[model samples]
Target: MSGKPGPSAAAVLPELPVTFRPVRTRVVLLTVGAGLLVVLTVVALMMPSGGAQPWGPGDRATMIITGLLIFALLAVLSRPKVVADDDGITVVNLVASRRLEWAEVVKVNLRTGDPWVYLDLTDGTSLAAMGIQPGGGRDQAVRAARQLRALAEARGTGQPGTR
Candidate 1:
């Protein structure tokens, strides 16, 4: 091994137990979902009953259900997040969550125009870290990627410079 010392963890790594998420995306999605639900419910309740097949209880219920479904979809869109601690990292995406030990991560990447950060695993597969997505805030995503990269380099079992 080279005699040169690597950067200290305190100097490059972020505080442990930190969480990252797409703030702007989450806010916008939740806000829009709530507004849409309210508007749909209001329209269903206030619709004039004039036609032969006038709006009935079933129709109103259907409208409400539609609104609920839309809101649920938006909730899913806002669910991506990553939690990192001394032991490992937990990544929660739209439909799944996975935990990885520091030694299992080889590199952290966030290329320009990419949707989110990616973790290169020791197993040869890459995992998308939707929590640090550029679509929500580019600068924030970059900072998060760098912090995660630093953590991986500091603690990963893989050889350094792989990032």
Candidate 2:
């Protein structure tokens, strides 16, 4: 046996206990992108003008650019997620990720006409939970929000697994 000692179980980090995300955000994004591409291809093929000039470089370039932009939008909108563990919670938004302890969190709520869930913090600042949106799968988002609140309360009360 080697003289080096192997890593012990005590040195390993416990897995985070909670994760919340939109149910079918990625699926909808991918489906839209693929569906757009397919429709575009079919339309291009069915163009009455059999001549090559109708589907020139300019037309192809425009389609490519439009598809790419749509995909980019999907990428941005699909980025948000929320995760919680023994330590605290991490909120990943469209363009930013913030980590905060349980004490920093005030509440999670969805306002009327709000596109997504909002996380109110103790510091008077609020973060958008873009991962939980009212569209596509409202039930899933509601469940996720409830789960997040329960997790926060459970871990924020200074008693682990007590709630």
Candidate 3:
């Protein structure tokens, strides 16, 4: 056998069990959500008790609950994430999450202006991978898409393209 080593698979493929998520989006959404909660708490406590409407305990509770609701909504916006591992890939969007084997993904694409990556599945349906969005980080998103594309090509039945 030749003493020379062949090209390393790890060099070509991204590290497995890699996770893709929007850094800026998560930071902004979580920070803003927490900030809004603090502001709401402060406002709730500062409100006068002798006002015409008489801000009572119930009123304060309502105000805090409203703030919590808003925070919950924002938290959903920060929930998109994708985990790629030896077994398969897991896609978590705002409201849905799905796991697919490597063979299930036929392609990975992130065309210009596309909000996020889209995976063409073997079922002829495309799944939106909100975890990698250009709006949060354009260059990072592209790089992630390319990495995902490489993974699909090397590990699955996906076709490679210039996308």
Candidate 4:
């Protein structure tokens, strides 16, 4: 045998660094939604007459709570995302987040008129990956779906203990 051995699979194949996020169109919604919230809050608070008057000792606390809740909700909805590496992917939706191994995903499906990409898992469950929504534009969504499929085909097949 030659002194040099054949390259191993890992050495021959480089990992794909993949990330998916809401399209730029989301910026518009985020800007408008957040701006509207801030404006309404200010208006309502200032309408108290002669100036912005403290409603009461509890006013500051109330405002803080309200603001935080609204901000958190908006942030979550407008920031759904997915990140995938060689091992697996992490999906972040509006109210939940999940980590999944490649072998867990059975298929990637994005049908016509569908709002977002959905991953059909081997465990008979499905996950909506809203980060690549059709609202972002057909072309963008298609491209993202293709990339995700390629990643899945490359690293998300059956494996020991994962099948």
Candidate 5:
């Protein structure tokens, strides 16, 4: 018999499917900016004028510019990405990225009435894969969970009922 080692378990397992969805950074930035603007406007209105105008052209311009900046930031931050495959899963956080192997994943749970997809791992950990859900509805979240489950099954690591 040949002395070569047999195929490793990883090699026989199916490759994990990889998928990604960009987060909506603009929306988040816009929401934040609007909130800040409202607060600032309220504060300006509340303060005593002391015989002076509460807001001038410069102030208005600043607020407008700042609001625009906030919108842009939100748009950028909201751009969450999802990457899944038979091997593992990956999620791009607000400013960083993380990955997990299929073996490490315990189960896939789609939170009902939630805006994102959640993964429950064997280690009693969970992760949120965002950006794929449109309108923050349940349908999209369910679809994502199915996709993750399918990927896990392909790798022979998913729960029995998940298949």
Candidate 6:
């Protein structure tokens, strides 16, 4: 032996577990939707009103519904606990949550129409890794995906060909 130390056991061996940032698509969608709703509401309020025209039942109902929706959307967006962490990869669906181990993932695919990063599971199922989705354009999403892939590889949990 050259007496030089071999690869450190910690370096050569795969990390037993890894954690991934939870997805946040629902939160993002909800926030954008809420903002749009507020804009529309403001526009409606700004429209010229007929002289002496009282609000009708239908108009009142529409206003009430819109108000309720705005409140609900705001409430959903305010809570910051949407992200989840777990033994493997944490999944946050805004209304749903899932934890998946490395073995459960078969591959990672990024396609044009798909847009978001997707994980192909061993059971013929797939999950979206929304954390990697670009909020603005393709470049941001691609960058996020690359970072995620690098993290997975560092933990030895990435699917083959991911890097």
Candidate number achieving the greatest TM-score relative to the actual structure: 3
lDDT of 3: 0.83
lDDT tens digits, residue span 73-121, model 2: 8877777777878889888887899898988776666555678888777
Looking at candidate 4, what is the lDDT of residue 119? 83
Clashing pairs in 2: none
Give me candidate 3's TM-score against the actual structure: 0.89
The residue-level lDDT of candidate 3 at 4 comes to 19
- Tens-digit lDDT string for candidate 1 (35-130): 999999999998767686688888888998999999999999999999989998999999999999999998777777778988889999999999
| Better candidate by TM-score, 2 or 4 | 4
TM-score of each: 0.88, 0.67, 0.89, 0.71, 0.55, 0.53
All candidates' lDDT scores?
0.83, 0.66, 0.83, 0.69, 0.58, 0.52
Candidate 3: where is the Cα deviation over 4 Å?
1-12, 51-53
Candidate 4 residue lDDT tens string, 22-134: 75756865776677568657755665444565465356456656766776666767878878887798888878889999988766667788888888788888899888887
> Poorest 10 consecutive residues of model 6 by lDDT?
1-10
Worst 10 residues of 1 by lDDT: 1-10
Indicate the residue-level lDDT of 79 in model 2: 74
For residue 146, model 6's alpha carbon misses the true position, in angstroms, by 1.5
Residue 1 of candidate 5: its Cα lDDT? 8
Q: Model 1: which residue pairs collide?
A: none
